[model samples]
Target chain A: MNQDILVKAIDVTKNYGHFRALDKVGLEVARGEVSCIIGPSGSGKSTLLRCINLLERMDGGAIWVNDELIGYRRDGNNLHEISDAEISRQRRRIGMVFQRFNLFPHKTALENIIEGPVQVLGEAVNEARERAMALLERVGLADKANHYPSELSGGQQQRVAIARAMGMRPDLILFDEPTSALDPELVSEVLDVMRNLAASGMTMIVVTHELGFARNVANTVTFMEAGKVVETGLASEVLSAPRSARTAEFIKAVHS
Target chain B: MTTASLTSSMSSTAETKYEIAHLRLVPKRHVGRMVAAAAVLVLLAALVRAFSVGQIEWSYVRDFLFAPAILDGLANTLLMTVAAMCLGIVLGVIVAIMRISGNPVLSSIAIGYVWIFRGAPALLQLMLWFNLALIFPTLGIPGLFEMRTVDVMTPFVAAVLGLGISQGAYTSEVVRSGLLSVDSGQYEAARTIGMTQMLMLRRIVLPQAMRVMVPPIGNEVIGMVKLTSLASVIQYSEILHNAQIIYFANTRVLELLLVASFWYLAVVSVLSIGQHYIERYFGRGSKSIRSSI
Candidate 1:
């Protein structure tokens, strides 16, 4: 484990019944790295993101954030599962954006952004509000501070979700297909926000089918096949001249 | 402010019209609705005539409808309804949460509670509560103050316990459904945001769930108002009980029953109107009231 590695998963295994979702997988993301995981459907790309956040627990192996083991504590050689309170405390350090853009429909855009900071971290209400406003402005939705999620378009909602994750000031943000649910025309706005965030040196792990965004914004690209990382390299080389037959086949299929 | 500008609203207009149209009517057959209305009116007119002009003694009913004793009974009935519903809703929320808490012990206890209270008849439960002394002669703790069970189990206390516990059983089901109505994504969002269970329920889950919970709960509240009449069976001195006592003495059973029925109808109508407004209030942020519980 390099000290510079912000997130590291060593031989992490997960199973749903007889199906192995993650078959002894390993991944490491350095601080300020924008790493993209690209794969076909059911290739465990989303499952990997979920495991990193402890939204779905891995049946075997362990995950670490910074220097701390996530969702568990090391006791001698045995690993003891931590309390939900502890898991949530760790989760506060990481932000996640869902495929469905899971904004709280009951609250306005500003309220949604401020909810995590004020409610979880106990930040001052006014402070959280001001920070939320700034993030909304950064996302180009400052004017929509009072708009409920139901009133927002899918692109606008995903942007707010991004701002909301940014409002946490998290060390890393995990995006699981954030633009999958948007209209083809609307995908550009969400991708633009991600590009800006990556350019500003935010650490991010994005699982996406959008090869263009992956190539344009991601520094590192990892190709996954059947719950295993098959290829890893710089985004340009991986997309243009991949070394694995599996990766080449997938890229050709996607391009065609 | 944020809109899905992927597609704009379309506008259209009719450019040409050739002919003005008139609605056609078939006059060969009588309208079913008209026939039904005529039948209903005649039946209602006959019933009203029978009640107003028959030997039920309308003057006795009119005199005692607003009498001091009858008014006192009405007051007692309203008090019982409010107090019992308050207890029921509070207990119901706890039980509903327990039922869904995922802890086997808590959920089993909640299930057993709903089963017993809902399974037994209300009248029987009331009687048991009133005579609770026979089963538990004294209510107390070791090294603490003690009192006779019968002394504590007054008719008023017994009535509230019986009606409220039963209502709580029904309300728990209604509340559980309401809680379930909220999307699971909301729960996950709260969890990912590092919200505790209590705060998640208070701020995120319940606010959304209330939109679905209000209408059925309003129905329960009105139902409780009528349910208080069962208190009279235990001599709780509510509206029906007062009427019963007066009729028992004066032998004006029909007149007394009519007054109670009128009051019941009046209270239910008022509660229904209140329910409509409350539903609208919680229904905000959504498109329409089409998804009401």
Candidate 2:
């Protein structure tokens, strides 16, 4: 119940028919803290991040952002599903950046950044455009604002995607493998931007394979395996000295 | 010589042995293509001679080109086409959305609508609408007002309803395919950005879907232009109907038919050009990448 906690998940469970994608997963992200969830592919790292934003509904338990339960409302003894409008209202403060850099292909970089502010929040066009331009500049893409997603390099597109997430003025941003789709050379550029964001005191939950980023930028690191968190501690403590054999093995494999 | 110089000299000798840059390049003759072209030209010339010498009177065709009745019919045809297409597109979007809805009842209703409308012949649908009075003698609010079905179901109404409803069925499939063509990631991105389902569809999904939809929708529009002539069966007074009436009186069937054909071709040609521009408009971001490939 700490007021500083931006995200709190308790016993979060998700299933894909017979296969449990996430099982009794619990995590906490304090305000202005970066938490990295690292695990092997299909180990529910991305699923945990998705469940936080209600992109994938949890089958059991709940998640809270900014002290308010997401996707549902408590009514006496029952938790009733909230209306889509209410869910959208709640989601307004929780931004998400995707691995594929799902920018509106029809829109330019500046337009993609301004879309949520202009359409969802109903901000003035000029105001939104001004802020969007600032975001473009912040991501080192000020000159590429007019370029479409196809016109951009993978690194540039991911930076624009990050700026798009920031443009909504989210209290927290969930990045679902944001750099997994990037080329090896492009990964560092996106990671650099994320590092700047972390330095700026933005709360973020990043599901990634980049242990180097986790070590440098993240305050807390959670190692997940088979839908369960294996270790959660300070980035240095967890990465340098993992308690779980699975975590160590996975880390060694990644390093190799 | 140093190793680099020795290697360069050896490579240059090897290159010169294979080099034939001074050879004259001769283009291959496409004998088959030339023969095909000559045959087509001869055929075209023969057809032109036959048309010129045929019993068709060019004077009547010229005189009737701008005739008031024909112009009125043209206007009516255009009006029907536009109105029916507007109705079709709106209904199609709704039906397509419903078809893909999670609710079983809505999906079933959409499936039934597509099945009934798309399966039946458009001609039969027009006849049924024209003669709807047989099934229901009156059509109006039950207690407030009453009007004869025959009066309400005029040729225009019947034709519009029949054509538009049938067009909607085909259009729904086109729209559904278009909607499906967009990546699932786009939907997730839109939702995360706090857009409502409708807003997401209107802005993110549909605009991207438009690139896939325009070509087929353009084909539908051109098809609709010609399909309006089918309404003539219900006395809708489209171009073909007016031409039929003239040919019936003057017995100048071929000339009048030719006039109608010319107009249809002209309208369709213009529409084709419009479709090209529209495709270009929707194909903004992806066009460059596609053309490069």
Candidate 3:
């Protein structure tokens, strides 16, 4: 409801057959703030994040990004709305990093980073390459720029994925368990990069099980259980000492 | 100190005993495998001898296989195989895109094409097109207000069309399976970066899918090489047809048939080898990593 919010979801619901993946979920993300969502496996955290990008369409309610209404295209009375192409174009402004570090396997890290800029933004190839090099350096993977995904370690690949997302110059970045698939020792490297991004004032929404990073980096931490947000507040308040029984139980489970 | 040394000696002996036991078991397993393999080899040799005993005519086979006309037919066979495969791959890519397109009508049209061609016997399809003159006297052109009849459906034209179209259907499904083999996440990744669907397909999805799809497609190419022999039925005068004409006139059925078979085998062997190298080239980077571990 805040005018300063970059993203607002009002009573958003997503249904699959008779099951409700997200039930009347409402949330808002303000400009230049990192919001971390923490939940159990089936708690619909991912569904909520995906709905923000219209990757998964919401069954009810409204979503606005930069005050532009999402999921509907007004026509002359008929309202022939929500084409895939339109959603894809909107998705450009909201970059998403998957749990699996979904870098294009066939392309080198440099090509992966430059692909979106050159192809979608119509930036010249050389310009895109230069920007991609800077991004790769920022992600601490300047040396590994020419390496393919298969040739890199999981941690390295995830960094390349971050660089790829950053290359698009999106308004917000969505991270779906970015470090969950990484090895224990490699987790810190990705978290360190994320911390740097956070410090630099990049708006990010991360769905992660790394409570340590979540506590250290996120401005707001939301706790959800079974398709509903149980508690959301300042990271230290929610993560260190949750209010609701469900949030407390989740914290206990994660910590233990 | 004496007691400690005695205990250590006992433990060392125990470890040696366990090692001996393991080593003794290994050779027994090895001997059993060797004996089983020997039996298989004996059985295979007996079967080969039985099948090949008096059927082969060494001299006639040697002479006919290397004949000038047969060699020419072999060249023609290879030419058609390469040309058809090149054309089929291009057509296959187009059809695969159509099949996966967002438009329902275009998708259905692609599905219908694959279904009709794949369901019908390829030989029958070839014959039908070759004999299409009987079914439709004229093919009407609407805008130009002209009609071109059965006279246009010459055997060569029909053969190429028939083979190419049928090959396209099978190749499309091959390509589609390849495309589908790529992770949907890759497409999403590319799109998020703002890559157009076409560019994404070209640079990301297709390259990866082609790696997965290559072996089956290579099989299709080899199969197409042999399938071109079907053109002989429509009097298209490919290798097999040319052989048939020579054999009928000379009345040397087995010898001439052998010549055709030899040529087919030779060309297919070369193509199969080429396919192996191609697959290896793509596989090398992945394979080295796997093998090193």
Candidate 4:
């Protein structure tokens, strides 16, 4: 019921054929809040994040971003799905970082950051270029501005991805395992950029296996298991001394 | 302790030797390599002899190669190649998209178009288009005042339609496979940023797909330059047709045919450079760093 909530899910359910991806999954993220979703694979954390961004249409229930219903428009008692263009317009305000830094292979690092704003927003190309340069600088990649994704290390690429998501100036940025694909030594650099973004009061919902990042940067930590939210609470409490037995089991397993 | 101190003092005063690691050279020979070398030498010597002393009538070739009619025919061949390719590529992009658009009806129609055009012999298809006047007699809006098919369809028009449609069938498959080669993550990444399907195709999917599409499309373009000869059957005034007219009167069939072949080689040779540049343009961001072995 909080008016300041940036994203709210109301019993959302998703299915891939007969397999349930999200089963009555519900969570709320407030404005400027860093909400971390932690779970083992196939636990619906990524699905929930995707459903919020309207990348994947939920088969049942509803998701709201800033009080606007995503993917569908309600008419009387029924919900009619909107056109792709409309969904795209809504998606412009929700940036996402994939596990595999999906920067355009044909474009340079700076070009990748500028593409979304210039193409989707119809912003002036020169203006977008300037902003993209600033982003590149912010991510400690000003020197690598003209380099392609392939030319950079994994850590550098992920930093560029974070900067790219930030360029949209989105209301919410969903990171679906942002650092999971990086080399062990490369993970911290990406996490550092994400940490800076969190400190700057950017709204981020990260789905990661990095328990340390969840404990440190996230304001709220959510544990998901088998297409359901096992527990959700303040980071210090839920992570350190989770009330749910499944959450405790997962924490112990991760520690071991 | 006394032995250890004595060894330390001796080692500090000892001269170091710069020793070369032992290296051995074994005389290894490949029977396949020897056989290949012999074949290549034989082929090269044969080619040189043919060029220098072969009865190709080099003087006659020179005289007719730049003949005005031959030049005009060359022009027509080039025109047909460029025009048909333009039309084919436009249709190819559309049909390729339709094939993957997730619409059953559109996909089926695209598949049917490809199947019929690609499955049948191209020469047969060209003849059918040429003789279409005989089959229909008149072609237009059924009851809205039909025009005679002969008047409506000239040899050039028929040639372009037949060649373009046939080329399009192959181009569609090449393009479809190219698009499929791009990772699904690229599409999802573009869609996540609020990019529409068309925008994504132009900016994201197609650029990446262009890398895969170029080599095959390059082959198609080179093949098309030669395929335009098929239009000769429709009385299309292309190189081979013009060459035939010259040879039929003069009774120098091989000489005129050589002239046409000469022109084709020239055009395709030039196209190879353009293809290389286009491939390089699309291949920019794909280079990964590697250390020397």
Q: If scored against the real structure, what TM-score would every candidate get? A: 0.92, 0.95, 0.84, 0.92
| Cα lDDT tens digits for candidate 1, A1-256 | 2439998898889899999999988888989988999999999999999998888999988889888998899999989999978888898999999888889877889999999999889999999999999999888999999998888899999999999899888999999999999999999999999999998889999999899988888878999988988998889999989999899999889889
Residue ranges of candidate 2 with Cα displaced over 4 Å: A1-3, B1-27, B289-293
- Stretches of candidate 3 off by over 4 Å are A1-3, A75-80, B1-68, B86-112, B143-147, B281-293
Compared with the real two-chain complex, what DockQ does model 2 have?
0.72
On the 0 to 100 scale, the lDDT of residue A107 in model 2 is: 92
lDDT of 3 by residue, B1-293 (tens): 69999999999999888775445443345888889999999999999887578566667678877778777777767766777777778888998999999989989999998888888887898898988878787786767665665677776677777787888899999899998988888777776665657777887788877877789899998898899898889887788988888878977777778778887888779888998777765553353534654
Name the top lDDT candidate. Answer: 2
User: Which of the numbered candidates is closest to the native, going by highest DockQ?
Assistant: 4
Which CAPRI quality tier does the interface of model 4 achieve? medium
Please, what are the lDDT tens digits per residue for candidate 1 over residues B1-293?
33544233221122224233554765776689889999999999999998778789888889998988888999999999998998899889999999999899999999999999999998899899999999899999967989999889999999999999999999899889989999887887787777778989999988888888898889889888998999988889998999999999999999999999888889899989988888877776676663553
**Candidate 2 lDDT over residue span A1-256, tens digit each:** 2448889999999999999999999999999999999998899998999888788999998899999999999999999999989989988999999999999999999999999999999999999999999999999999999998999999999999999999999999999999989899999999999999999999999999999999988999999999999999889988999998988998899999
Per residue, candidate 4 scores C-alpha lDDT tens digits across B36-98 of: 999999999999998778667777789999999999999999999999998899999999999
* DockQ per candidate: 0.50, 0.72, 0.37, 0.74
TM-score of chain A of 2: 0.98
Rank the candidate models, highest lDDT first: 2, 4, 1, 3
Listed per candidate, the RMSD to the true structure in angstroms reads 8.4, 4.3, 5.0, 5.2
